[model samples]
Target: MSINPNQYKLSDRTARLTAQDLLPTTVSAGTETREFLQKVIDILLDYVKAVNDRNEKVLDFHHPEDMKRLLDLEVPDRGVTLQQLIEDCAVTLKYQVKTGHPHFFNQLSCGLDLISMAGEWLTATANTNMFTYEIAPVFILMENVVLTKMREIIGWNGGDSILAPGGSISNLYAFLAARHKMFPNFKEKGSSSLPSQLVMFTSDQSHYSVKSCASVCGLGTDNCVMVPSDDRGKMITKELERLIMERKKMGHIPFFVSATSGTTVLGAFDNLNEIADICQRHNCWMHVDAAWGGGLLLSRKYRYLRMAGVERADSVTWNPHKLMGALLQCSTIHFKEDGLLLSCNQMSAEYLFMTDKQYDIQYDTGDKVIQCGRHNDIFKLWLQWRSKGTEGFEQQQDRLMELAQYQVRRIKEQSDKFHLILEPECVNVSFWYIPKRLRGIPHDRQKEMELGKICPIIKGRMMQKGSLMVGYQPDDRRPNFFRSIISSAAVTEKDVDFMLDEIHRLGDDL
Candidate 1:
C-alpha cells in the first residue's frame, strides 16, 4: 500500500480543489484577474489619448435624463464578469467632459501633467490614510519639504504649512488660525468668550470662501465685511481703513483681513502692501487668498504684479492645482508663525498621535489639521515640482501671461465683434461677444441688458456644438461676459485663436 509521491499529491490536491478556490483575492486567483486589469489599462490609455487629442470634442452634451438612459447604471445583486465591468467604465468615460482638454476653460483647474498623474496613481495604490507618520511617513516628509520650499518662495524665514483639500478649505484654515492666534482660548470657550462680535474683512471681489469660512467659524456672515473695491476691482485701502474704524466703534472685534491676490471674476490683485499696513494698524491678522495667482510667485517677471508684501501677511492660501499643473485639490495654507496650526486645530486622539511612539513625533502633522483622514495631495505637487524644476515653473508662468496678452490683443483687434471688459491683470481674459443685432448699439443700458441675455444663448449653442468651453458670470455693474482662463499649460496660441474664432462662429448668428 506504499503510494508514489506524484500520484499521492495529485490525488490529495484534486480532492481539495473547488470552484471558489480559483476565484480572486480574499477569495482566490482567477485567470480573468490579469485580463481585467489589462482592460482597465486599455481604457485609461484611450482616455488619455482623447484628452490629448485637440480634434476630440471637449464634452458630449446630454441632459441628466438622457445620460441616465445612455448609461445603463444599475446595481446588480451579483457581480458581473470583467468584460461587463470594462464596458461600464467605457460608458462612464463616454459622457465625461475631458477637463484636461486644451480648449476646456470652464473651470480654474483645467490641465493634467503626466508626472502628477503618475503620482496620483501611485498614491491611489498606496491607499494609505494621512492620519499619522506611521501610515504616511514618506508622504509626511514630502509634504514638509514642499511646504518649506513654498515658504522660502514666499520669502518667509520660518513658518508652518498644511496641504488642505482645496483653496476653500485653506481659506477656512486661515480663518481658524487667525481666530485662534488672536484668542487662544476661543476654541475651548467658543465665540461667546469674546466680549465683542468677531468680524473679518475682505474685498467685495474676493472669493465667496471668506464669507463661507466666517460662517463656518461661528462668525455670522454679517460679521464678514464686504469692503469696497476700486473701479479696477482692487480693494480700496481707504475704505478698508474706514471699515475697521467703524467696526471698532460698533464694538465688533476686527481680527482678520483677507486680501485677494487674484479675484474670481476680474482676476484682480488687491494692494497687498497697503492692505498689510492697514492690518497692522488695526492689529488684524492678514491672509492672502492667492488661490488663482500664487503661481506667479515662480515668475520673477510677474511675482511683483500681485505678491508684493505677501511675506508680511500672517498667512497665505495657495492652490497649485489651479494655475500650476498639479492635479486637483492640491491647496496649501501657510502661516508666518510656527505652531499656529497645532494650537488652532490639534486634538490628540488616543488611538492616533500617541505619545509613546519611538520616533520623533514632531513629524506627525495630522494633529495640526481639522481633517483626520486627508488625501495624499502633496505627492502630486512634490512630483510636479521635481519634474518641472523651479525654472520650468517660471517659464510656465511667463507663457501663460504671454498667452493672456495675446488673447487681449486679439480681442482689441476685433473691437466691433467683441467688447473687452478691461485689460486682464493675470490670465483671465473677459469679454462679451457682440451678436449681429447688438453690434454698434452705442453700449446703452438697454443694449447691455440685451447683451447679457446673449451670453447664455451663445453658451448653450457652444455646448451643443461641443467645440469649446469657457465660463461666464456677471459682476455688480457688468453684464454676463465670457471669461477665458489661460490656466492650462496645454493651451497654445492656436488654441487661443481657435477659442476666439469659435466664439465668433457660434455667436455671430445669436
Candidate 2:
C-alpha cells in the first residue's frame, strides 16, 4: 500500500478515504495530508484574487432563511470525504462577504495585508497556546518586542502591555486595572469591601464598551457618567470636571475616566491634554480608548495633531486590526505602571504557571490575563510591522487621509446632491445622499427627516444589486446617514467615485 498521494488522482483518493486516514499518526498519511491542505490553499488563493478584483461584488446578500437553505450547515453522523470538504470550503467562500474588497467601507477593520495573512496561516499551523513560553516561545518573545515598540511609539519610556481579543476587552482590562490599583483590597473583597460606591466617566460619544465595562465591573450603568460632547463630538473638559465634582459631592469615588481618542460615529478625537489635566486634578485613572484612531499615531503629522498628551494617560487601548490593517483580534492594552496587570489579574494557578520551570518563569505570562488559553495574535502584527517599517505605515496613514480628503472634496463638488455632515478629522467620511426629489429643498427639520429615510432604502438597493457596501446609523444628534470608513489601503479615488455614483443610481429615483 503505497502512501504517496501523487500515486493516485485526488478524486480517486478522496473518494476512497475520509479525514480519519489523514491523521498525523495514521500509517503514512503525510503525503495525503499535504495534498489535502494544498487543495484548500488553492481555493483560498482564488478567493483572495476575487476579493481584490474591482469587478467582484462585495457580497451576495441573503436573508437568514435563504442562507440556511443555501448552505448545508448541518452536521452529519458520517464523516465526509476530503473532496466534499474541499467543495464545502469553496461553497463557503462563494456566499461570504468579501471584507477585503476594494469597495468595502462598512467597518473600521478592513483590508487584508498579505504579510499579516501569511503570518496568520503560520500561527494557525503552529496551533499553540500563547499563555506559556513553554509552548509558544517565539511568539511570546515576539509579543514582548512588539508591545515594547508600541509603548515606545506611545511616548512611554517603559510599561507593560498585553494583546486582547478586541478593543472592548482591552477597555475592560483598563477598567479592571484602574479599579484594582485604586483599591487594592477590591480584588479579593468585591464591591462590598470598597470604601464607597465607585464611579467612572466617559464621553457620550465614546464607544458603548465603556458603559458595558462599568456594568460588568459591578458598578451600575448609572454610575458610569456620560460627559457631554462638543459640537465636534469631543468630550467637553468642563463638563467632565463638573460631573466628577458632582459625583464627589454625592460621596461617590471617581476612580476612572475614559477619554476616547476616536469616537465611533463622528470620528471625533477628544481633547486629550485637557482630559488628562482634569483626570490628574480629580485623582482619576486616565485611560485613552484609541482603538480606531491609534493607527494615526504612525503618521507623525497626524499623531501630534490628534493624539497629543496621550502619554499623560495611565492606560491606553489601541487596536492594530482597525486602522493598521492587520488581521482581526489584534488589540493591545498598555499600562504605564509595569506590574499593574500582573498584580490585578494574576490568580497564581499552580498547575499552569509553575514558578519552577527551567526557563525564566517571568516569560510565563499566563497568569497576567483573565484567560489561560489565549490565541497567538502577536505574530501577524509583528510580521506586518517587519514588512512595513514605521515609514511605510506612516505613508499608509497619509494615503488614507488623502483618500478621505478626496472623498470630502468630491462630496463638496456635488453639494446639490449630497450633504456633508461635517468635515472629517479622520478617515471617517459621513454624509447624506439627496435624491432628486429632495434636491434644492430647504435644509429644515422636515427636509432633514425626509432625507434620513433615504439611506435605508438606498442601502437595501445596494444590497439587492450586489454593488457595494457603506454603513448607515443614527447618531445621538442626527438621523440615519452614510458613514463611510476608509481603512483599507486598497481603496482608491476611483472606488470612492463609484460609491457616490452607485448611491445616485440606486437612490436618484427615490
Candidate 3:
C-alpha cells in the first residue's frame, strides 16, 4: 500500500484530475489539491476586488431560466475536471449579486470585512460542529466570550446567549424562551396545556419574523396582534397599551411584547423606555428585535438616542451581520436570566450530553439549543470584533448614520425629483424618485398610484443596466418607494450621491 508522491506531479495528468483525486481519498494528490484550491482562491479574491470597485456593476443581471442555461448547475453522474471546477467558480461569482458594492443598498446585511472573511474561511477549514467543548473547544470558548461582550454592550451585567443561524431563528429563540418562562407546562403538554389563548404584540412595521415565530411556536398568527405605528413608523405607545388592554379583556394571556428597535423599511426606533414600562406593568416579556438596529449599542452617541431602554429588555435578538459588517448569518439572542435557555430547550440527549464526561459538562451547550448540530458562526464575529474593537464598530455606525443623513438631505434638496418618505432614525432612507412625467403632479391618490409604478420600472432598468441595486417596497399607507439602506461601512457620501444621481438617470423619463 506504499504510494509514490511522484505520481501526483503537477503535469497535464494532475490538471485533468477531479475532486475525487483530492484528500480523504487519494492523499498523495496534496500538491494537485493545493494547486486547484489556489486557483479558486484567486477567483474569489478577484471577485472581492471587483465588488469593492465602485465602477463595477453590482450584479450581472440574469433571468432564472437564463442563469440555469448559463451555468452547469446540475449534479452530474460524473465529476468535472479541476480546471472546469475552477471555471465554474468564476462563472458563479460573475452572475451573483455584489452585496459588498458601495451602491448595493438593497438589504440590511451588506459588506465585505476582510478580517471576518478570513475567519469564515478558517471556520470552514476547521469543519467542526459547535455542539460540545470536546468537539469545538476553541470555538465554544470564543462564542462565550463574544456573547459576553455583546451582553455587556447591551448594558446587561450578566446574561445567557446563543448564536442562532440567522436573525429570524434568534427571534424565534426569544419567543420560545418567553413562552417557556411564562408557561413552563406548555413544554411537555403543548400549547393546548396553556391556561388561556396566548397573544403577542409587535408593531405593524416590525420584521415579519415576529409573526412567523408566532405561527411556528403554535401561538397562532391571528393571536399575534399588530400594534399600529405612527406616521414616523414608530410603535404608538398609547395604541400599544390600548391593544394590550383589549386583548386581556377578551380573556387572552398577553405573554410577549416585541418592540422593534429598527423597523425594516422606515428604520424607526420604538419608544423602548415607554414599552419597557408597559411590559413591566402587564408582566409581559419585553423582547427587543434589534436584529437590524442592534449595532447602535456600540455607538456612544446614537445608543442613548436610539436604544435607550434596551437594557430593560428581558431578551434581545441582535444580528451583527446587519450593521456590524460581519459575514451573513451571524445572529445572537441574549437572555437576562441565566439557565432559561437550557431549561426551555434542553432535551439532554444521553448520547451527546453524557454525565460521565471528565470535563465540566456544563460547557456542553448543545442541549441548550433546538438544533443538534450548530454551525460555528461565532468565529467571524469574534475575529471581526478583535480587529475593530468597540470604537471601530462605533465609527462604522456613526459613518452609516452620516451617509443616511446625507442621503436624506440630498433627497430634500432635490425635492422636485425625489420625495422623502420620512426622517430616518437609523441607516434606512426611504423615498420616491419622481420621474419627469410624474413631476409637479398634485399630491393625491392618482399621483401616489403613478409614483408606485416608477419604482418597479426603475428597478427593472437598474437591473438591466447593471449599474445599481436598491430595494423597493410598498407599505400599508405609502405606495411603492425605494427603501435604500446603508448597512455597509464601505459605502460613502460620494456613493450616496451616486445612488441619487443614478436613480435620476434611470427613472427620469418615466
Model 3, span 29-148: residue lDDT tens: 778778878877777788788888888888889899988897778889989887677777777777888899888999999888889999999999999999999999999999999999
Writing each residue's lDDT as its tens digit, candidate 1 over 326-361 gives 988799999999999998989999889899999989
lDDT of 3: 0.90
Better of 2 and 3 by TM-score: 2
What ranking of all candidate models by TM-score puts the best one first? Answer: 2, 3, 1
Candidate 1's C-alpha runs over 4 A off are 1-31
List the global CA lDDT of all models. 0.86, 0.91, 0.90
Each model's Cα RMSD: 7.6, 3.6, 4.4
Off by over 4 Å in 3: 1-11
User: Highest TM-score among the candidates is held by which one?
Assistant: 2
Clashes per prediction?
A: 2, 0, 0
TM-score of 3: 0.97
| Ten-residue stretch with the least lDDT total in model 2 | 1-10
TM-score of predicted structure 2: 0.97
